[model samples]
Structure formats: C-alpha cells, structure tokens
Target: MYRLTTHSAIAEIPAEHWNRLADPDTPFLHHAFLDAMERHGCVGESLGWLPHHLALRDGDDRILAVAPAYLKFNSYGEFVFDWSWADAYRRHGRAYYPKLIVASPYTPATGPRILTGATPQRRDIARVLIQGAVQVAEKLGVSSLHWLFTADDETDWLAEQGSMRRLGCQFHWRNPGYGSFDDFLGAFTAAKRKQIKRERRRVAENGIRIRRVRGDAVTESEWAIFHRLYRDTFDKRGGLPTLTLPFFQDIGERMGRNLLLVLAYHDRNIVAAAFNLIGERSLYGRHWGCFQDFHSLHFDACYYQGLEYCIEQGLTRFEPGAQGEHKVSRGFLPTATWSAHWIANADFRQAIARFLDTETRDMQDYLAEMNTHSPYRADALPDRIQAVS
Candidate 1:
C-alpha cells in the first residue's frame, strides 16, 4: 500500500530514509542538501517555495519512494523558463500562479525525480507518485504541473503518461580521457587554444590571482563576502537573491569537500568568487559574483577556473550553469536538457504540445549550427558528441 501526505518541512522526513532513496553518487539529491535549503530559510512559504514533498510509504511504514515538490507562486529561479506559458494563460483569462513544481529549488542540473526502492514494485511506486502530482493539480485547480531538469528516466516515464515535453540546451564540458589541463586544451583548435591562453594571461596581468578552496578551507568570513557578491550580482539586475548567507555557510560547513570556491584576489583583497558543487563525476558551476568587473574576469572565474579544476581533479564533466553561447566558443559543448509538464486544462495542454513540437526542432537546428563553430578539432569529436546537434 502507498500513502501520501504534504510535508511541512524536509526534517519531517528522516534523513536516513531519504538518503536511502537517493543515489549516493549524487549529493544534491541527498537529505542534507534539501534540509539545508529549508533549515536556512532559502525555501519555504515566505520564499514562495512551500514544500509539498511527496513520499510513498509501504505497509511496514517504511519510506519507499519520494519526490521533491513545491507550490510555486512565480517562476524566477527555475532556469526552465516558463513565463511565456504563464503569460499566455493570463491572456486567455486563466489563473497560472500556485502551480505545482516537482524539482530542486534554484537548481537546473538534471537528476532523478522519482526515487523508488530496488524491488519488483518499484515501477508501480513511480507511477503512483506521478499520479499523485496529477491528482493534486486537478484537486487544487492549478494551471499546470511541471517536472523541471529531470533525468532521462523520469522524462521517458512522464512522456509515456502523455505529459507535454520541452527541450532546452546548456553547455557542458566533458573530459575526454585527458591526463592533464594541457592535454585537454590540446584538443581545441589552434586559434581557440591561443585565445584561451590570452584570457588566462589577462587575469594574471590584472594583479588578480585565482585559488580553489574546498570544504573546510572555506571560512565563514569568506562565505559572508561571497554572499554579498551573490546578492549584489542579483540585485544589480533588479532581482532579489534567491539564497541566504546562512544557507551558503551551512552547506560549506556540512558538505565542505563537495563545495568548491574559486576566489579571485587583487592585492590580497577578494574581489570576486564562484561557488561550485562537486559531485562524484561532475562539477556543477552554480553561482558567481564580483565586486568589480575586470576585463575577461567573468570568463576566467566562471569558465576557465572551473574547467581547469575539472581537468586537474580528473572529473568526467563540468556543467557551468545554464544558457551561454559564449561558453561554446570556450570549449563547452551544446547539450540538450529535458523538462516534462502536465497542464490541467485540455486546451492549454494541446496548445503547449503544438508549441513544443516546433520548438524542439528549432532547438535541434540551433545546436547543429553551433556545432559548426565548435572550438575542438574535427578528429577530437566523438561520434556521440558529434550527433548531439
């Protein structure tokens, strides 16, 4: 038997039980990560991300599966970009706020959505959890439901359930069995190679030095400065900071080694910083902020610094956040991202389906054009990578 309930807090669910459902390889899905978000007040009713997490319990009252869900009043931090869809609903005199979102708050990296036990009944558990979302959407009379930045398995199952699928692209760097940073750079074309070298040189010439400190090396004072940078970066753009300083400090203290902080200093004064999360095989470049905008500083701090770290650490992939064609020129390759949605209204559902069909094809074409301008040599491109566009 399966039971459903709205979780008031992530702590309401035991950490051990939640961790059991998550893959040990992906730390972002772990209980500590979600708990830190809520515990630090980064997510909750006040932040417009009310936790309505779903769980499947067995007859023995053991947690079998789970999904991180939220009741969203507006879509801001979600990189999946659904504002136009919301606007269309309003144009047609429909209410679009208060939609149910099953995703990681303020995170766009794809990972498992449905966490089930490794037993014969696992598939059924996933189905039931998905059905729970649909039922809840209907009961609440929300405009739609969305499962953003989900892994391939979740997308496949949701598609089978007739959910409208959408495709977006992000640039990610993959290690191609390179032994060192130099070896990795050798794969790039001659001109692009020289360009990267110049950019790194510019950072050094500007009296700025970059350092990578992980885990315990990140002090509270460093986090406070980084938080200010993060807030200023968002505030300057006329938006509110989605995360709190305490949240960063908490994650750094608890998941220190997994936390990679790239700091840029000028004359021993920190001017900019980028915070990244290191998973088992991938590095997620999530946030960055700088007090001053030095030439080529953003690229050096965000892209070059992260890529070099990945190569040195022998990590498999580096996903430096979302939406940057400029990253492609610096050796990041185009990769397709998936998000699945279920609109409660039939008319809106059909309309979105029609839009997605055309959008997917256009995205494919855009990626194809991007490939022709890749920084890598033709011989270095693997068959699988070549077929991405």
Candidate 2:
C-alpha cells in the first residue's frame, strides 16, 4: 500500500532523505539547488514557476519516491520547447498555462526524474509517483503533463506506460580515457586538431589568462562580478535573466565544493566567466558570459576550459548546456535528449502522437548525419553509440 502527496515547496522535505535517493553525479537535482530558487525569489507564482513536488510514501510513512514538479504558466525557462503545443491549444480556444512539468526547473540536463530507493519496490514507487502526478494534473484541470530531460531508462518505461516520447538533440563531450587535453585532441582528425589548437593559442596570444576558481574560494565581490556577467549574457540577447544574485550566493554557500567558476582575465581585469557544477562523475557547464569580446574567448571560457578541467579531474562526461550544433565540430558529439508527455485530450494526444512519430524519425536521421561527420578520427569512433542518460 502507498500514499502520494504534493508539496508547494521543496523545504517541506528533508535534504538528507531526498539526496539519499538521488544520483550524486547530478547536482541540479540536489535539494540545495532547488531550494535556492525558491528562497532567492527566482521561482514563484509571479515568476511563473509554482512548486508542486510529488512524493510517494510506504505503509510505514517512509518516503519511497519523489519527483520535482512545477505548475508552469508559460514556456520560458524549460529548454524542452513546447511553444508550438501551447499555440495549438490557444488556436482551439483552450488553456495551456498551469500545465504540470516534472523537471529540474530552468535546467536542460538529463538526470533522474522519478527518484526512489534501491528497494525491490522501486518500480512500484515510480508508478505511484507518475500516477499521482497525473491525478494532480487532472484535478487542476490542466491540459497536459510533461517530464522533460529525463534519463533514457526512465523515458523507455514512461513510453511503455502510454506517455508520448519526444526527442531532441544536444551536443555533449565525452572523455575517452585520455591522459590530457592534448591526448584527447589526438583523437580528432588532423585538420580539426590544428583548428582547436589555433583557437586556444589565440587566447594566449591576446594576453588573456583564465583561472578556475572553486566556489568556496570565491570572494563575495567575485560572486557579484559573476552575476553581472550572467545578467549581461541574457541582457545582450534580450532573454529573461531568470536566475537571481542571491541564488548564486546561496548555491555557492550550500553546494561549496560542487561549484566551479572559470574566470577570464585580460590586463588584470575580469572579462568573462563560466560556471560549472561538479558532480562525483560528471561536470555540468551551466552559465557563461563575457564583459568584453575577445577573439575565440567564448570557446575558451565555455568549452575548452571545461574540457581541460574534465581531463584534469578525470570526469567521464561534460554537458555544456543546450542546443549548439557548432559544438559538434568541436568534439561535442550530437546526443539525443528525451521528454515524455501525457495529453489529457484523447484527440490532441493522437495528433501529437503522429507529430512525435515523425519527429523521432527525423531526429534519428539527424543523429546518423552527425555521426557520419563526427570530429573524431575514423579509428577513434566508438563501436556503439554512447547512451547519455
């Protein structure tokens, strides 16, 4: 027997118990990270992120499963774009706002969505969480429910349970047991190898130096500068800067060693920065910005430096944010991303099923296309596609 409940805030749950069920390698799902958003005023009804986290409990009242969910008013921060679906609902004089999303808010990285203990009843717990979420959505009368950027294994299970599976591509770099960055580059073709080397050389020749500062070591003033750079990134592109300054400070304080800041200096002045969250087995490249434009500085601050860090730290994978095909040529291979949807309306669900079927085929063909032109040398290509979950 099981009981399911939803909370309006993550703080209602204990951090220790929640983390005990999470993969240590994915820091975005950490209680500290999600709670920071709420505490720092980044998420709330006014901000369009209303918390509605789901939890499954056992007969003894022990929490057996959990899923981080939100009642979204609009499709802003979720990188799994659903604007078209929203537009469809609007055309039919229906509502899309208040739809339920199970995800790490504002994060596009894939990790565990349905978290549970490693007990014999883990699958049963997941089912309860899923059904509980759907019941909550139906009660709220929302048009749909979505699970975004989910793990591959869970995505397969959701599809089997009648959820519509959608596919998208993101470029991610993998460490191939290389001794150093140079050794990693050796796997690339001669032309690409020289191209990357030249890009790195451009930064040094321009008298720009990069320093990788751990979060605990960062001063209060440094955190301010990093936030400014992050704001500048969205300001320049005319995008909403969803993250708050306090949020940055909070994560640094609570997530300490898990945070890494890569700052670029030219003439003793900070010109750019890239922020990463270090996990036990992976490094996640999240925020990046620059005050001044230097030649190939984005590559250095964003990609090359992170790659070098991964090699030095012996990290197995690096997920540098979302949607940049240009990263593919820079040794970041095209990887498929997953999202599962439950449409409440049967007619609309069938329509989306047809659409997703076509999208899935096209995504498969696109991945095959990217593989034919992978940056790695012919001999270095792996025998099997790396299933990034």
Candidate 3:
C-alpha cells in the first residue's frame, strides 16, 4: 500500500531521498534547486507559486515516488503559453486560477514531472503518482492539472492517464562530436558560418570582453550587478521577475558547479551577463540581461558562448530557453517540446482538446517549415542531428 501526501515546501522531503527519484540529467528538478526557490521568496503563496509537493510512500514509510508541483494562480513564469486558455475559461464564467501544475517552476527544459526510483516497480509508482494528482485536483476543485515540459517517455503514460498531449517547439543545439567551436561552424553553410563569425567579431570590435564565471567565483557584488541588469530587462518589458537576488545567491552556493554566468564587459566595465545552469550533459541558458545593448553582444554572450562551453565541457545538448525563432539561424535547430494537460470540466476539456488538435497540426507544419530553412550545410548535417523532433 502507498500513502500520497502533499507538503507546502520541498524541504519537507530530505534532499538525499528526493534526489534519488529525480532524473540525474535535470539539475533543475533537484531538491536544493526547488528549496532555494521557496526559501528566498521566489515562489510561495504570495508570489503565486504555492508549493504543493507530492510524494508516494510505502507501508514502511519509504518514499517510492515524488512530484515537484505547485498551486499556480497565474501563468507568468511558465514558458508554455496558456493565458488564452484562462481567458477562455473566464469568458465562460469559470475559474482558472489556483490550478495544479507539476513542473520545474519557470523552467522549460524537459524532464520527469513525476520522479521514481530505479526499482522494477517504477511504472506502477508513476501510475500512483498520476492518479493521486488527479484525486488531489478533484478534492481541491481545481479546473485543470498541467504537466509542462515533460520528457518524451512520459507522454504515452500521461495520455493514458486522461491528459491531452500538446506539442511545442524550442530551438536547441546538438553536439556532433565537434572538437572546437570552429568545427561546429564548419558544419553550417558558408553564408551562415560567415554570418556567425561576423556576429562574434562585431562584439570583439566593440571593445567587449566576455568571461565565464562559475558558482562562488562570481562574487556577491557581481551577482548584485547581474540581478540589477536582470531586473532592468523585466522593467523594460513591464514584467515581474520570479527569481530574486537572494535566490540566485542561494542556488549559487548549493548547486556549485551547476551554476554559471557568461558575463560581458565593455571598456573594462560590466555591461551584460547571461545566466546559465549546467547539468551532466546539457547547458540551459535561462536568463540574460544587459545594462546597455551593443550591436551583437546578446548573440555572443548567450548563444555563441554557450555553444563553445558545451563543446568544451563535452555536453551533448544546449537549450537556450523557449520560443526564439531567431535562434534557428545561429545553428540552434527546431526541436519539438511537449506538455500535457488534464482539464476537469468536460465542456472546457473538449474545447481545449479541439484547440490542441489544431495547434499540434500547426506546430508540426511549422517545424517542417523551419527545417526547410535549416542553417546547417545540407551535406554536413548528421541524420540524427537533422531528424530530431
């Protein structure tokens, strides 16, 4: 027998125990990462990310499965677009806020939402976690339950659990055993490769030097400067930032090597920085901010720097956040991303199902179109690199 329980914080579960169920490749789902988000006021009931963590325990109180979850009031930090769905609900006089979401908050990178150990019974444990989530949603009377940016293997299970599958696209760069950034460029078309070279050269000609700082090597003062630039970007867009300065500081301490910054300096002064999180096999470019904009500093500090780091570090993949059609030209190719949803109300469920059906077709067509404009040389691309979806 298993008991399903919910806690208001990730700290409720021991990090050692929680990490045991987490996907080793996804550092974003680690206990310290989620706890840092909560302890530093980045996410909480007040901030609209009320932690509602789920766990499945056996008769002897051994944890068998866990889900990093939240009671979300609005979809601000979530990269998966669902604002229009909320509008649809409101138009029909239905409440959409305070819904249940199982995800790495604000992270669009794909991994498991329901984490299970390496036991042979892992499939059964996953089933229990999903069923428990549905029961909790019904008991709480929420309108919907969402699992965002889930890994591909979880899709069939989620669909079997009565969730509608949705397809989205994000640009990602895959390593093809390149020994250097130049080798990476060699695979691209001559025109595109020249364009990339010009972008990097322009940043250098503008008197900017970029450095990669990892973890504590980044001083408290520099982190402050980074956050100021970070907030400045949000201020320009009239947006709110979910992660706070203390939050970044805390993760920098806890995650150590997993945290890094691609910092850009102009005239010996800090002008911009791109914050990235590292995993065993991937580098995730999550945040970027600049005190001032230069001709091509963003591409240099964000995309090019990350690609270089991935090759140098022997990482297999680089995900540069969500929804950047512009990233396609810079050697980041179109990659399919997935999310799943369970709508409670039947009528609304049908409406969303119809919408997703159409959206999926549009997304597939768009991905195909984007591929036709692929930046890599037609003959240079490996089949695995070109055929990813």
Candidate 4:
C-alpha cells in the first residue's frame, strides 16, 4: 500500500528517512541542504516557492520515497528557461501561473527527483509520487506540472509514464583520471591552453589573489560581502535576487565544508566571489559576482578556480552553472540535460510538444557544433560522454 501526504515543512520529514534515499555522492539532496533552504525562509509561498513536498509511505507507515516539490507562482529561479512556454499559454487565453515544479529552488544542478527506498516497491513509489503530482495539479487547478533539471534515469521513467521530455544543454568539466591540474590542462590544445594561462596571468597581474574558503572558514563579514555582491549582480541584470542573506549564513554555519567560496582580493580587499557547493564527487558553481570589472577576473574566479579546486580535491566533475558556449573552449564539455513537462490542457500540451521537438533538434545540432570546438585532445574525449539533446 502507498500513502501520499503534503508537507509544508522540511523538518516534518524525518532526517534519517530522507537521507536513507539520498546518495552520499550528492550533497544537494541531503536533508540538511533542503532544510537549510526552508529554515532560512528562502523557500515559501511569499518567496514564490511554496513547499508541498510529496512523501510516500508503506502500509506500516514506513517512508518509501520523497520528492522535493514546490508550488511555483513564476519561473524566475529555475534555469531551465520556460518563460516562452508560459507566454504561449497566455497567448492562447489560458492561465500558466501556479504550476507544480519538482526541483531545487534557485538551483539548476541535476539530481534524482524521486527518492525511493531500497525495496522491491521502489518503482511503485515513483509512479505513485508522480500520480500525486498530477492529482495535485488537477485539484489545485494549476495549468501544468514540471520536473526541471532531473537526472536521465528519472527523465526516462517519467517519459515512460506519458510525461513530455525536453532536452537542454550545460557545459561541465569531468576528470579523466587526471592526477593533477596540469595533467588535466595538458589535455587541452595548445591554443586553448595558452589562452587559459594568459587569462590566469592577467588576473595575477592585476594584484588580485584568489582563495577558496570552506564553510567553516567563511566569516560573517565575508558572508556579508558575498551577499552584497550576489545582490548587486542580480540588480545589475535588472532582476530580483533569488536567495536571502540568511540563506547564505545558514549554509555557511551548517554545511561549511560543502560550501566553497572563491574570493578574489585586490590589495587584500575582496572584489569578486564565486559560491560553489562541494559534493563528494563534484563541485557545483552556483553564483558569481565582482565588485569591479578586471580583465579575465570572471573566468579566473569562476571557471579556472573551480577547475583547480576540483583537481586538487580529486573531485570527478565540476558544473559551473548553466548555459555557456564559451565554457566549451575552457575544457567544459557539452552535456545534455533533461526536463519533463505536463500541461493539463490538451491544446497547450500539443503545442508545446511540437515546439519541444523542433527545439530539441536544434539543441542537438548546437551541441554537436560546440563539441567540434572542444579544448580537449581528440583521444582525451571519453567515449561515454557525447553531446546530445
């Protein structure tokens, strides 16, 4: 037997129960991470993300699965870029707000969506959880439901269950059994390698020193400066900041080692910073900002620093946020990402299906073209890794 419940609070779910379904490899899915987002008030109805997490239980009330879900009033923080879909609904005289989104708020890192228990009923739990999402959409009268930046396994499973799968691309750097940063850089072509070296040299010539501060090492003053930079960056882009100051403080206090802040200081004064989450096997670069523009500072602080940290830490992969063709030449390979959407309205669903099919083809071609310009040597490219849409 399967039971479904809507949870307004992450604390309501037992930490051990949720952690049981989470792989130690991915820290973002750990109960601590989600709870921090909630405890800090970063996710709630007023913030445009209302927690309505779905929990599945067995006959004896044992938790089987859980999905981090939210009721989204807008698609601002989700990096998957679905504003066009919302506009399409409005153009067709339909409502698109209040859609059900299964994703991490203000995060584009792909991970498991359905957390199932270690039992024969794991698949059944996923089916039930998805059905619960559909039911919630119908009951709440929302226009649609979406699962953003999900892993390939969940995407395939959802597609098998009639959800429409959409393809996207992100540039990520993966370690190829590299023993050191220089070894990894050796794989790059001479021109690209020279370009990177020049960029690093430029940052150094400007009297800027970059340092990585782990969670515990991040002082309150540092957090304040980082938050200001984060807000200023969003403001300059003419958008509201997605994260609250308290969110940063809480993450620093609770998950400090998992938090890596790459700070660029000029004359011992901080000028730029890149906030990254350190997982067991991957480093996820989430946000970046600079107080002043310096030549190649952004690249040094965001990409190169991240790569160096990953190399030194022996991490397997580094995902430096979303959507950058320039990352290809910086040794980040084009990787395909997947999302699933469900539009309750039949007409809108068909329209989106048509649009997605064409978009997928275009994305596929774009990834292939980008791969041709990859920095890595031809033999260094892994056979398992390919650009797909």
Highest lDDT scorer: 3
Which ten contiguous residues of candidate 1 have the minimum total lDDT?
380-389
Q: Please state every model's RMSD to the true fold in angstroms.
A: 1.7, 1.4, 1.1, 1.6
lDDT of 2 by residue, 81-118 (tens): 88998899889988878799999888888888998856
- Could you estimate the TM-score for every candidate? 0.95, 0.97, 0.98, 0.96
Error of 4 at 220 (Å): 1.1
Off by over 4 Å in 3: none
lDDT of each candidate versus the true structure: 0.84, 0.88, 0.90, 0.86
Q: Which candidate leads the pack in TM-score?
A: 3
Q: Candidate 2: lDDT of 365?
A: 90
The residue-level lDDT of candidate 3 at 89 comes to 92
Better of 3 and 4 by lDDT: 3
**Residue pairs whose backbone atoms clash in candidate 3:** none
Off by over 4 Å in 4: 117-121, 386-389
In candidate 3, what are the lDDT values of residues 319-361, reduced to their tens digit?
Answer: 9999888999998888999899999999999999999999999
lDDT of 1: 0.84
The pairs that clash in candidate 4 are 215-256
TM-score of 1: 0.95
lDDT of 2: 0.88
Pairs in clash, predicted candidate 2: none
